[model samples]
Target: MSGPTRRPTLRDVAGRAGVSTSTASLVFSGKGPVAPATADRVRAAAAELGFSGPDPLATSLRQGRVGTVAVVVEAPLREAFRDPFALAVLDGLADELEAADRTMLLVAQPADDPVRAVAQLSSQAVDAGVFPLCGIRDNPVVEHLAGRGVPLVGSGSPDGPGMAHVRTDEEAAIGLTTQHVLGLGHTRVAHVSMNLGLRSPTRAARPDDLEAALYLDAAGRLRGFRALAGDAAPVAVAADLTVGSGEEAGRLLLDVPADRRPTAVVCQSDLLAAGVVRAAWALGLRVPQDVSVTGFDGVDLPWLDATLTTVLQPGVEKGRALGRLVRRALEGEPVADVGFPVSLRVGTTTAPPPA
Candidate 1:
């Protein structure tokens, strides 16, 4: 008895169907114009030979395309999607990717052990990789995936060769609000920061934290804040992006003696700013009258009653920029870094120091 029957190949079908190999290939790939009768003959031969088009793996290996992109998010999906800004960015990215006839494979990198993501992604055959947001400056996955010759794109950080970025000047972006409050004559100012270091807790920022910070955006913003607010100005870091974390940070800076309390608070995100507003209300402080607050990312907060003085960086547009970069990189185009623009929008939340 025979060990097994030989598997079918496209060439076998082409030979049996009495058609040129290229014509048979066109019938399967749908890339070129083929006569209906000839296409029917190829399909009939394929059916007779128990063939079902080409093996996807063999096709991809030949074409250097998996037709899928790995979207790496440094936080768990549950935690990452909680932030509206993050959701908007993801939405825009999804839209652009769908239009390109590409599929997105979201890879959530654990906050505690990012290296685990490299292990998980090693088995996946992706055409490209995307960080897509401001995340850890030094990521292990960057080197691992780059070694496999996958093109990479992101908004900031996890930077390296074979990677294109949609750049944002985080320091200058943070300064837009920092300067706004300073211009308003608020001397006793404070800041609420997102996590400066990975897997860190909510607390006051320390010198050690600044040096060891892996999140490039947060570090840049802190540096920008320190540049204007002096080295000794107070900074309370949030545990995460939630309003609760923001509130905790807010109370740290605001729950103090009238003389010691900051007259103004500048937060890193709109969610944090909203929390600060809540914290101020709990402490019986009138916003913009007793204590002014400002936030970054002018994301829409429909439930919040007050407007935030924030840096207007459109998350959707930023995501689209990242997608566009990825598209260009995949098309064998010479990729270069593209700058993403942001502007300041003043609102109801900021004012001069209370006399």
Candidate 2:
């Protein structure tokens, strides 16, 4: 049997193409200037010799930059992406990163132990880091990455010095729905909050829970609702940001005696509000007639029959804002915290309370 043939190299391709190895490299990297015919010849030779391209490791070593950005999310990939708002933010972030010729290295940080993310990311090489969603107010990953001089960007959590943020006024944003319900003459209002910590159960929110909350977004929104609705207003916390959790939270607030049940239910997310609607229906309660429902993060819900009164958060735009902040930081520009605004969208789900 004949000896195995040697794998083709850049030198072999260049020789076959009648060009210098440097010229072959230029064609492959799309750098410097090369005639069209020369480039074509190099590609043909590469094809025949089965030479794909130069080594990525070599290229990165020479460039002094790894073109990957670390995108940190505080949940498992499937769980996080299940929320439409999360998907929108990710899509927008991916778009801008693609435009800048960078790739994303997704890092899912466990909520129970955020420090675990630090270990996972320690071995990875990334040009910058992003906390793309609302996570714990403080994170060990922030400190580790900051010590390494990684450019960091975030939205409303993992707050610390030197990190640029696309800040959302969580309190004012949730107030959009709270004020709307108040305007609709609903005095008996209930709030559904996203989980304030890892493995939190769906149950009534207590004053102590708000005081010790780890998730700032949820805490801020709860404060906003309390600010308008009063501190004694009933509030339920979801186990997670899921429809199922929302349904559970809804039952806690809605499955009560008619007189005690809140006339209007305001949720921190559309998914939770939809769940409340389902729970209300299950209990033979007609929406807007028995209970008015409102939500935050105006995500599209095709399965629900009624349009939701919600806070128009524009997740994609908020994501792009985060991306821009990351880009600016990477470019050595002085990036200040950017404020993202939210608006109230009136819909069929909210109406004047039943007489």
Candidate 3:
């Protein structure tokens, strides 16, 4: 056998069709206008010669538009995607980017090495970047990309640069939730927060607060609760933001004797609140009757019959805003820091403290 017939080339098609090389190039490139008849002849020749088109590498180089956007997350990929709030936001982002025919490159970097992942923007090549606001603080990833003049948009407010930020008003949401508990005539309120670390933004970490480090979101919610209460907000940091942590925190809070116990508990997330409710029931306490409970993030939890009085922050909107920001950055437009609105959803979970 003749070494599997030799591959075809543009020159082969041009010669076979009795057309100039430039004419063949024009026909395939679709740049210059060519007579319809001539174009048809070139196509026919290419088909006969089994020629496809130019190399993809050459085409990409010529276009100079990579169809990829980097989405950097500071948390583990499994945890970030598994969480309902993160999933909703990602879904919204994927929808917008897919509509625009752009691809998303998910980058999960540990808090310690955020730079390694972000450096991919320059080393590898992406049209733009989208990071969660918390991930952008003095983050190495943000610093590298911003240094390279790469366009950036965030799902949350990145502290260093005034990049396009799309996030629900976490402060406002927590404030409303806190006020609800306070309004119910509950003076002794305890907040169960997720641990983000003393280094996280949202809360200006006090030297003493460092002993009870929590995540950035947790810190912010706690700060908001304190600010709204006009008093030092007593907080118990959960090992993490999970139902188990909430349960443990609940037990710890309630063990403080009825007189000293908080009449109401504010959890950082819906999952945490649910855990607290379970803990309360285990202690023979009825929700909102013996002890009131509230959660942040309007996530659905059917098991808890009590309406979860919480903040309805727009998770999908945050994702969409981040996608839009990436598109704007790709188009060479500047993005400004923007904050989304949050609403309070009153549920039966919260009530006036027992007299």
**TM-score (all chains, Cα) for each model:** 0.91, 0.93, 0.82
lDDT of each: 0.90, 0.91, 0.74
Per-residue lDDT for 1-355 in model 1, tens only?
Answer: 7688988999999999999889999999999999999999999999999998888889889988988999999888888789888888988888888888888999998667899999899899998899987788888889988999999997888888767889889889999999999999999889998887766678998878778888888889899999999888999989999999988888999999999999999899999999999999999999989999999888999998899999898999988888888888888898988898999999999989999
- Candidate number of the best lDDT: 2
Query: Clashing pairs in model 3?
Result: 133-156, 195-214, 195-215, 196-214, 196-215, 197-214
lDDT of 3 at 328: 76
lDDT of 3 by residue, 228-309 (tens): 7654655766765567777887887876677887889888788778888988989888888889998877876776666788
List the candidate 1 regions with Cα displacement exceeding 4 Å: 1-21, 37-52
Name the candidate, 1 or 2, with the larger lDDT value.
2
Candidate 2's residue-wise lDDT over 254-321, tens digit each?
A: 89998999999999999999999999999899998889999888999999999999999998988888
> Which of the two, 1 or 3, has more TM-score?
1
RMSD of 1: 2.4
Ranked candidates, highest lDDT first: 2, 1, 3
TM-score, cand. 1 vs. native: 0.91
